[model samples]
Target: MSKPAADHYESLASIPAGSSAHRDLSATELPSDGDIPRPVDLGDVHCFVQRHHLAHHTVVFEKAAIIVLGETPLSSVPGITATELRALQQETENKWKQPKTLYFTILVCSIGAVEQGWAQTAMNGANLGIPKAFGIDSNSKHDAFLLGLINSGIFLSVCLLGAWLSGPINHRLGRRGAVFVGSLICLVSNTGSSLSLNWPQLLAFRFILGAGLGINASTVSVYAAEVTPPLIRGGIAVSWQLWTAFGIFLGFVANTAVYNYGDEAWRLQLAGPVLPTIPLLLTVYFCPESPQWFVKNGQRYNLAFQSLCRVRNSELQAAKEIYSTYLLRRAQSKLDSREVSWSKKIAELFTIPRNRRAITASYVVMLSQQLCGINIIAYYSSTIFADSGFSAFGALLASCVFGFVNFLGAFPAVLTMDTFGRRSLLLLTLPMMAVTMLGAGFSFNIPADRPAHFGFVAALIYLFCALYSPGMGPVPFTYSAEVFPLSHREIGMSFAVATASFWATVLSLTFPRILTVLQPQGAFALYAALNIVALVLVFLFVPETRLKTLDELDHVFSIPTRTFIKYQLTEYLSWFTRRYILWQKNADLHPLTVGEEYQALVETDYEEEDMP
Candidate 1:
């Protein structure tokens, strides 16, 4: 019997045993043809990989045309020049560095974060005006509950409802398309809210708006994470949080300026988010679909390769990244061998240990984001400031201060996030946050008549925002965005966002009542206690996920849950030492530094042939 063409191609592409494993590799992992009996034509490498299942196990040049001289074997070529080799090396270097298209896409997609943030706190200020415009009596306890239900209550409920809807939207329209639809929904809802003459009309439109932004919230972060290189992924992915804080800052600025406008100013404040949405919709039209999404949908060449090239920056980098994408497709294809229903696929998200852990981690991180009490400050800071004895304008100014400090907080996050890594920062910040919340609780216990005491409270609040900025504020969203497999990234993030909003709604509906019953000090103390619980959750459940590719993570989480602690400690110590050295050089002198070993970043845990 004759050997098949596909099998022959696989043999040609396979690396030799003598070559260094990817973990110990010195240069590009692509080996020379020293072990081959005879050379194969260079022009056919991509075509063979595109059609051959086994060819996916090794890296190959994606663009055959770039090699030129179709009949020549790369190793046997007498005509190849130093310039051609240098051009290839330079292209690979550019791809290894940040590519413009990838960064631009990240920037444009981050506008979704801006819209989400704008909506989140806009109502915080609008609450002052909207209740008055409707002539609703908010004097009694019942009215206060109704007011909470109208403002944050409805928004968060549908926000979660929208998150569930995002799965189908991403599956159907893809991540970019889902973002566009969600942004349009934001524009329409914000426009409708501005024009709404009655409270019910505003509530209805806001509900729709929440659903739209929910879909966006679920999509944008993953869109950024999937497209970024592993080395710079954390820094770039954290842009989602940076822009979100900026949106919150802008919301505070707008609300402060319009506080004097009384009833109508709320309309302009509500409409503010639409400005960012317009540009996002315009630009996301040009951004590529996720390379994994393309491949999983069975596109082997065009869309998948192009998107991978844009995101990974060159054919070689794209080739390396696409190995994981190809593995994902191979896994999905195996499941397709039997008649796998949609319900089965959904079940696998939990039944598969790797995915199950990811979902659990995402839920914990997200719920912690809300339960840690940051949103209470973010969504109701003006209210919080008012209760602390500020005049209405003074309250707005204090909020502007919070917004400025909050914006400043995100700057340090971007710089340290990749270098210091996620787990170490979380461990440090969670404790710091616990202390700050405790201090704020004590501030509430101070007598309101003592204006001198107000400065202490104000200082605590600023310090809290400053401390919160670098870690708890951004890391959860950034982590959740990167943790899922490409197949589940959309729905996984939706679940994370939805879980966060669910808790947020719980606190929003109950917070005003908590204040009414417990008063300010008691409520602040309650938030402090909850933050402590959130810290415990982080300590126990979350694992370090720095410098890992998404597919690389598939192996780590696949290990039994019992082993999580060892990995967590290992990653933390690695970055802690690096950061300690930096701090020693820059700040406090500590001889304590990381003496560590990392088995290279992109090396796969599973053998090449062991994939589905």
Candidate 2:
């Protein structure tokens, strides 16, 4: 293709020229410790002033080394020499040209299947089973409380134990193996729930089920974050929300399908998550482990590179492109020899500032999720319908509808998360939630003579589920996971989510009392108030994690000026388009070089002495 016009070139350039711009060079630049930095050397350079003020500057360096021409008030150039310029040019090129892949879709499916299935929606099905076993005709407030406790009990344990296992599991088994193990446990525990005969038996099974669910929930987030290309890290991180929507939808379908089967239907509904686990296991089995995790564990550099290329379906050279980035990052982060024991790592989350902020943010987000009245609706939808003048069967149908709306809403999270961003969506959705909750609660407060009015309450509740599916239901987990550090990711997230489960228990057990003592209006008003609080917390604390890479995020956090959302969005878009454009722009840049030219170049780059 022909070169673009001068205006097009100006628009495409990232660095600005003239006194309007400041030279934002690194305060202290580091040299490359490993691998050849990928800039075309522009050779030697000399500067001379030809005439009056209209002098021109020429830079002879690497062909592809990025150049910026900025105007200064000084009549002559600075004392900086050609050698300094070459070193700076090579470093910048290496910094800019790292390769990336889009394997998050693979991760999205794997983690989505397990996380959405067992942790979130599968429990929604169990809400029906609780009342069925307890012999509650109307599902009184007491029963609602018990059901929440049953679900939340395991969550409490998850908070306690999840951190303990996260580090070891990720360190020893690797990302893929640890995640698969978690999924397997979930598969078995969900199946066990289907066979339980009584409330006590079901409760026991749920505790075991929660343990597996906890592991799956925490580990998948860590694995997904570790494996993603930095450019689309935020978008990939949000996939957890998308899959959760899927699980909620599936729960509804399964619950409705067995509605005609009566009490035994709860058993089938409990087992619904098992269907997705098989594929989740199979896909994760085939996918490569996280390259970063492998490098952290002391694997060879080329092996990690090849693994990335295998999943990316790109050329072998792409391995160097990716590997070179890790080397630079590892050096800069001072991660070369930084190894702490698992126990110490766990403690560090609380003691360290970065980890503290992230973990606290996670806890707040998760606690906010619990306070949203999700469990009250999840477990008591049928009971609420019955109280609102529907038959027991009609209540079950209404519950099914809630699930349908929840499921359908998840797809949009996948689409919108990367577009509108996490913080923007969180800020926008909370007010809508307030309106929906008020509508549902106020419907119950209206006079009894209003015919079909209770149905409006039910419809408003359904709208709440729709609103939740896209924002509250899915976004928090992804956000929590994103904020956590790699050192303690699994445990930190587990602790946060476990808190959600704990509150769910509190809400479940108390909702019956709350509804009865203060009436339905008081109960929903409490949740609406909590939603308002969550909105404020999100505005102040939650960052937009839509586009950032894991490495870039580390750097962003290292500094203190900009919030996470600002840097996250900027860093992502910068490289997201550049990597692909590199290949498109240079069709002639390939691995199939003619004979000795390629062999000698490869041999000179990698000798037997440097094999390790």
TM-score computed on alpha carbons, candidate 1? 0.78
What is candidate 1's CA lDDT for residue 324? 41
How far in Å is the alpha carbon of 609 misplaced in model 1? 29
Show model 2 residue runs off by greater than 4 Å.
Answer: 1-115, 118-129, 135-145, 162-164, 329-336, 447-451, 485-491, 543-612
Tens-digit lDDT string for candidate 1 (1-612): 011222233433344422334222311222333333433344455554657442552344433332321233444335434544443455446534566788788878777888788878788788777777887656568867766776664448555578877777887888899899888988899899889998778878878888898888878877776677665666777787888998999899888988888668889888887889899989997887887667655555456666877765346546545544443344344333455455665676676565777877787788888877878888788888888899878888899899889988999998888778776687778777778778887887778898755787788878878878898888888888878876566666767777787888888878877877887778878877887888777776776777765444754555444445454456644555666755544342233111121123224322322211
lDDT of candidate 2 over 1-612, digit per residue (tens):
001111122232333321112111111112222323333222311111121111222221111112222222112224444544443444335432332333543544554444555345555555655566766436466565566566565565555554346556877888777667777776787788788776677677667766666666666766766555454455566666666655665676666677788667777878887878777777776766777776667644445655665544233223323434443443334322455675676687766545665665676677777777776787667767766777766666777788777778776886687788776777778879888998888888666557657678888998988888778877778777766655566666766767776676567657777777777778888889988988767755565566655543443333322333344345533443454555444333122112333223222322222210
Q: What's the CA RMSD for each of the models?
A: 7.9, 16.3
Candidate 1: 10-residue stretch with minimal lDDT = 592-601
Q: Which residue pairs in candidate 1 have backbone atoms (N, alpha carbon, C) closer than 3 angstroms, thus clashing?
A: 577-594
Tell how far residue 150 is off in model 1, in angstroms.
2.5
